[model samples]
Target: MSVHELAVTESVIAAISMQLPDSQVAVVHLEIGRLSGVMPDAVRFCFELAGEGTCVEGARLDITEPEGTGSCASCGTSFPARDALAVCPCGSADVTISGGAELTIKAVEVTDDV
Candidate 1:
């Protein structure tokens, strides 16, 4: 999983660099949810290996863990759910998950000139 994530992130950075040839990326903000099945520590460890010799070698990685959100089937109320427990306030076990499975690059900080 960690190796896969590293490959994906490296590819994304490469694509961005190609599109913006004049820019030097400084930071990459990543939105990592608890339900995303990705370990932040694993990703961070592999990121350095993946970025070796690349333009993002020394770039900073900012990870954000978004709270899980779910909708209760009993009351139809949507609210933040526990990250791991994922229990609804209404005590309904038939809740449908709406969010917290996201793994995306929120933003990239870049310098026009280095």
Candidate 2:
């Protein structure tokens, strides 16, 4: 999973480079979820390896941990969850995940050419 994510990130950076031919990316903001099955440490490690000799090489990576959210159908209540165990305070097993399973690039910082 980590290898795949690094490959995907590299692809995204390449796409961005095409749009900003004169500028270089300096940083990338990533949103990582606990349930996304991605470890932050592993991603950071793999990013360095994957970015070798690329335009995104040596770019700073900023990661955000998004908490999981779930909604209860019994009492129409929504609350934050920490993990896959989504038991509502109202004791409702009928819950749907609303967030925290996403891995995405939120923003990219680019350096203007001289």
Clash totals for all models, in order? 0, 0
Error of 2 at 4 (Å): 5.0
Best by lDDT: 2
Please report, as a residue range, the 10-residue window in candidate 2 with the lowest summed lDDT. 1-10
Please, what are the lDDT tens digits per residue for candidate 2 over residues 1-114?
467677666666677667765666788788888777777777877777777666667889899989899999999999997777788999988888889988888888877752
Model 1 spans > 4 angstroms off: 83-91
Error of 2 at 105 (Å): 0.7
Candidate 2: residue 63 Cα off by (Å): 0.6
The superposed Cα distance between candidate 1 and the true structure at residue 34, in angstroms, equals 0.7
On residues 1-114, what C-alpha lDDT tens digit does candidate 1 reach at each position? Answer: 466677666766777667656667788788888787777777787777777776667888889998789988899899887664566787888888888888887888886666
Off by over 4 Å in 2: 1-22
What TM-scores do the predictions have?
0.77, 0.81
